[model samples]
Target: MRPTITGLGPLLDQIGADTGMTISTLGVLAAVPLVAWALFSPLAHDLSRRFGQPRVLLWSLVVLLAGTVVRSLPGPVVSLWIGTAVIGIGIAIINVLMPSVVKRDFAGHVPAVTALYTALLAGFGAISSGVVVPISHVELGGDPAGWRIALLVTGGILLPFAIAVWWWAHRGRRAHSRSASQHGRTGIWTDPLAWLVAAYMGLQASMFYMLVTWLAAISMSTGRSEVVAGVDVMVYQLFSLAGSLLLPLVLRGRIERFAPALIPSLAIVGAAGLMLAPGAILVWTPLLGLSSGATLGMSLTLMAQRARDHDAASALSGMSQSVGYVIAAMGPVVFGWLHSLTGGWTASLSLLLAVLVLLTVVGVFAGRDRYVLDSR
Candidate 1:
């Protein structure tokens, strides 16, 4: 899932060269999957209810695998766009279902489990971002277009193994047994707390996705070589991993109350640093990375922690991610458009900083300990 977004950063130049698409167009391409995420996320809970989480998740993996192949195929540009949307659909379902799974199976250990998975997510994303360029430079089959193979290897290779592992793990598990009667009578969409969570999710996700899509390009624009820029992205992801690992440890007792707001404040600092002092990327990158990872972990945790049950968790996850990715899908395109229009990154970085401020405000309210749809 991470590779589909982060891994594509390093390959964008090559893709542009091959497709003759401008940065803004490529930004739209980058955002296609996010749009899919927004569109498909809402259906995941219902899909899981009908087919069960395990089955729906397994099918999603298959869809992801298929999308990976299609996206990597050497063909018309439309294939690339279609495949990306397919990949987004798969990931959207998986993203929404994961919280419910954790809520159901790791009810008492939500933070720890969310941390573990999010850490792995960041770690793999870092690996993909770091390695894709080098792999694309490799002369496989004497083909000059190594980016296709790089995309395939980075995004497609482990999917089958994951599918097998998932199947084996839940071979006989039944679908979620909860019925409509088990859910809150009021819709999760109407709950103020759920809206707060969704706002936090959208804001944080917009920041993360925007950076992953353009951070390497932003680094390269500063006169760094492509390889060095890729390294910068890797560093960002590693720091994100560190942040993910550290969040659960720090969220104990009283600290938990302020963590949501505090973490986004750190991100605001990072974005400001990037805008004001672009030369010190190494310093700012880690700040952004840490904040990105921790905020992501916190958002996922909120989905589970604030839910009354796994059902509510699914509903909350669906709503938050659905609304969240819609906002996120705009970030890269708008950022790229700003850069294209202004001929500089000042406006683009300002856009990011402004969003971070809004995120911080939403996080303050989202941090409260409350369940979705609760009358209290």
Candidate 2:
């Protein structure tokens, strides 16, 4: 569900052409959601408290579907921004609340369920990237509106299941905010480890969004065709899926260990490869995929493990993603502008390499064996 918004990043070129916008303008489409997530993430706890998490999730799906329809509508550039922003807002709510649900429901198997969530997200995201062009051309019978058709069809498939899940979960449930602390069980606002977690999340999210937006185009710049480049993106996701599945076995629920450092370090190495040898995408793609996927799995796991209870999970999740996304919101726009300014890929790729380095350092702090509720 979250990956659907991300999948749109790789289609920026097509969107630009259709909307008669520049690359810089199209970059906004990718970053807009992050910005919205930043703004909306902190509000999740309040809404869930007032209306129940299950019901809130259903409304999120409804708004998400509406955003898709609005984006697919034939209109000027404004519709794209409006629709994308709406989509981002919906995703924000889900992102902030889902961790609490997982922490409460699957408390005994945090890493395993985190892995499952990552796998689903990465798998569908890869499918979205790989199929958009084919679905546009073949599924839509060569219509000029193929991209729009593809978006609608994908949303159509996901919406029903999303609705059913929320509907089932909401049975006999009601809002319960009468006596709960408004700030959740603890105050993570001043915790240094909390800041580290947010930094790790922001940095990793920046790199991930950058790849989703530029991977295919970057590969294509290396003399590969669009289809082949898209396949490379799929291959990356497959490796990511592997990493996600492996993370649970690697550390179980204990994340604050020396072994986890290898995850983001691997991403740093692969990112260096991307800068130096863009042509060998097949080689570096797996490295990035594996490490990035593991990093994501850990991030979600940490959101749960770093909190002692569901209330604290809600607080920490809201804080981590909100601040982190605000930091990440600049990635696509800055990356695209760098490419435009330099007229080459080297500068942009180098910047991402720097981000990966910072991601590794902060991830270590985030992986520490402490909970937000245990702080001073």
Candidate 3:
């Protein structure tokens, strides 16, 4: 999921060259999966209830692998869009279930576990972003479509291994034993606090995806090479890993209320830096990455903490991510459209700043330690 989100940044130009598509059109490619995420996220809890989490997750992995293969195949442009949507659907299921797993398995250690999960997400995303371009440069099989191979490697390579491990971990487990009655009803959709969480999730997700999809283009627009721009994204993701790893420490004290707002404030500085000093990308990219990583961890932690149990966590997770990603899916398209409309990145980046401001404001309220569906 991270690879699909972040790895494609550097390769967008090459893909555009191969497909004869404009950058703005390709921005829709980035959003396709996000749209799938929004559409499919809400179904995860129901799926889990029917087949159990492990089985559903295993099936999602298979779907993800298939999507990766389909999208990477060399042929009709429609395959790319189709495969991207499939990948989005697969990830959307996993995204909603992951928080529930943390809530169930690690009950008391939500923040710590979420931090580790998000840190690894950023770490793998960094590797994918950094290496996909260089991998495309490798003359494997004398393939002219090196970008396809790069996408395959980054997106599908580990899926088989993951599937094997998952199956082995829960081989004979009774997946179909769980019933709807075991998980109580949840009114997450109508809850104002849930909406706050969803808003924060959506806003942060928009900012993250916007950067994932366009930061390389933004860097290249400033006269950097594709490889250099890729490196910038890699560095940004590495710092995001750092931020994720550091979040547990930051949240250890009584600063929970302010941490949400405080962390995203860094993104304001980063977005401003991109606009004001495009030359100093290295300086600002880390700030953006850190903010993104920490805020993501915070958001996931909130999903877990704000629920009474794993069932509620899954429900809230599904709801928040479903609504959140609808908002997120718009980010890249809007950013690209803005750039195409204005003929520069200034307006596009200003949009990001405006998003960051909204993110900060929402984070303040969402960060309050309150459980969803709690009558208190």
Candidate 4:
């Protein structure tokens, strides 16, 4: 995710320089994730039922590696789309299964562990987004081969995970085959709490993806260097990292007591930062990050909090992510389209503010002291 995101600014630059594509044209690269979601979301659950969750996690990375390698291949515009689509499928699988992995493996430590995982994950993403341009500028051999080097870095990062999984499988890890142990079924899709969680997930995801793809550009428009814009992106992500760590601690004793107020307040702060503070972006960026990070961490934690056990967690995870990501997939494209039509960032930023307002209202419902309707 970090690699894909980090590469976006440079990727767009590369495409524009080489092929005369516009930002909108390059943004279409995001469509690959949506297409994969539509194609493979149904398959993820079926595969989980058959091969089991851990195996699904392991194999997804293998496929992800293959996709990354193929993306580096030299070709015309078709290569970018095809490569991205393959990568999207791989990411989708991993995205759906990770929550299950967390529920099963970490058990009672969901909040702390989820925060740690997301922080580390986004931290790397932050680093990647900030550096991809510089790295490409310095290391790329010119022509298409430079893009290949950028792609290779991601593939290289994924290598160790594959090796570790292989090692763990050979050692006969027992957790891979164990079934999720929760009792009672409350058909999650029909539950209102599930939808609330899904909405929270979707809105947060949409906001983050849209900003990541555009924030550097946004800063650049403000007369900052791309490097400074990249650093601003990092500042936002760093705040996210800090918020993840801090919010979990803050919510530990009072998840049920304070969550409703806490979650919406965070979203409100983020919305303010994004929509209302262009002049003070240096200050607002980290504030936005902190708010977003807290909201995101809390949202994931709520999945475990609302579910009765690991089975419920896995099911809710699938439902929320499957639905949430599809919604999220629309964000960048929509924002870009709106930007195109409006001829500037103002209208698009306003639309996002509206989304955040909606997110806050819905997040209050999700963060309430209630379990899934099926659970209790």
Off by more than 4 A, model 4 = 139-145, 161-170, 174-186, 255-257, 264-267, 270-277, 373-376
lDDT of 1 at 188: 84
- Per-candidate TM vs. native? 0.97, 0.94, 0.97, 0.89
Residues 170-201, model 2: lDDT tens digits: 77777565456655534777777777778877
Q: What lDDT is reached at residue 342 by model 4?
A: 74
Count clashing pairs, candidate 2.
0
Question: Residue-wise lDDT of candidate 4 within 159-274, one digit each (tens)?
Answer: 66765866586455443444544231337778888888888887877777777777877787778876678778777788888887876677756565556446546545655765
Better of 2 and 3 by lDDT: 3
Report how far off residue 254 is in candidate 3 (Å): 1.8
Task: Report the number of the highest-lDDT candidate.
Answer: 3
User: Candidate 4: RMSD over Cα atoms?
Assistant: 2.9
Candidate 2 has what TM-score? 0.94
Q: Score candidate 1 by lDDT.
A: 0.89
The regions of model 2 sitting more than 4 angstroms off are 139-142, 183-186, 252-256
Model 2 clash pairs are none
After superposition, candidate 3 runs with Cα above 4 Å error: 141-145, 177-186
